[model samples]
Target: MHLPNGIFMLQRVQTVYMIVAMLCIGALYLWFPSVEDAAGIAVIERSEPLVFGLIFASIALAVISILTYKKRQLQFVLNRLNIILNFVLLGVFVYRSLTLSGETLVSEKGIGVLLPIISIVFLVLANKAIKRDEDLVKSVDRLR
Candidate 1:
């Protein structure tokens, strides 16, 4: 599809950041292992409703933000929401790992816990870029 002149989503730095953050969240679903049961089998699968819902929400937010690039304020708002979601995801990971019965030590926690943190960082960067662009627009508007 031909994007109109300068409106291509991929042309924006924040869009790239958002896409990366989404990918990281996706990776978290696939790579991160859930708490293991007494039989040593992972209790939660990526397909689990709760886990899948959060991941889907995160990816959807990123995509919606990217599509709303023409509306900088809306994009910024969406990015902020996405960051909050990532924080929630991280908290869930922490709570799950810590509350597991009889499980101790840091090594048992899967690398999945870090994915939300990574997603948060990238979302923050995207928000910063969006803010920068918004500032530039406002300054230019003032000059007119």
Candidate 2:
């Protein structure tokens, strides 16, 4: 089946990214790990300002991305900005994983590997979508 010009491919990857983001936010709800389990995270989490800044920035970015996807007339700036912002958020996650108090970097768990891998995949797909969008615009301009 042919995808329409404006449609986003690799949406499933974005869905997965979004799902993981949700899971991370819900992490606090799922279980408050013991201080011992917290590793370095407790120390990090307590610096309330930095953690809140990260949370709000991520939320704003997610909202912007969603709004960009929904608009019929795409703004090129938003398209590029969205990709950069997603990468920034990905960096935030990487920082959280690395600097949290308890542990060495690169846990043995398979799922931990998936997060950055997933972010990178979606970043590529989102750029592809933006390129497709610009190409479509060029085609339309040619027709005119």
Candidate 3:
């Protein structure tokens, strides 16, 4: 299959950052339970519909951002949207963690709860790189 010229090229740093962010979210599906009960049952796992949807949506956005490499401005905008979506996901995790009783059913909050923050950091870095690329292109155009 003949792919487009620039699509899927790993030449840019932003693409790597975005892929890492996507992987971080995807990792939640493995063994990272968001919350566990005293009985060792997963109180909140990636299988939960809401959590699943949010995670999938974030991943989709990252993929789309990566694919739109030719349009730097659009790619940058998509990254911003992805960042906002991650913030919403983080908010949901925080709210859920806060609502669960700490002493009783809520035994421990898993490291999965921090995945959104990690994803957000990568997204921010990706955006910075995208912006830098855009500025470089603009400066080149100015020289002409």
Clashing pairs in 3: none
In terms of lDDT, the poorest run of 10 residues in model 3 is 100-109
Clashes within 3 Å, all models in order: 0, 4, 0
- Distance from true position, residue 83, model 1, in Å? 0.9
Over 26-130, each residue of candidate 1 has an lDDT whose tens digit, in order, gives 888777675555565665556678777888899999989988878999988898998988888777767766676655433355667788888999999999998
Task: Flag clash pairs in model 1.
Answer: none
lDDT tens digits by residue: candidate 2, 36-113: 222333333323565445445544554455445545235335435545544664465466556655364333322332
Candidate 2, residue 62: how far the Cα is off, in Å: 2.5
Candidate with better TM-score, 1 vs 3? 3
Off-target runs (Cα >4 Å) in candidate 1 are 1-7, 34-40, 104-107
Residue 53 lDDT, candidate 2, scale 0-100: 59
Order of candidate numbers by lDDT, starting with the best: 3, 1, 2
Q: What TM-score would each prediction reach against the true structure?
A: 0.85, 0.47, 0.90
Q: Give the Cα-based TM-score of candidate 3 against the true structure.
A: 0.90
Model 3 regions more than 4 Å off? 1-4
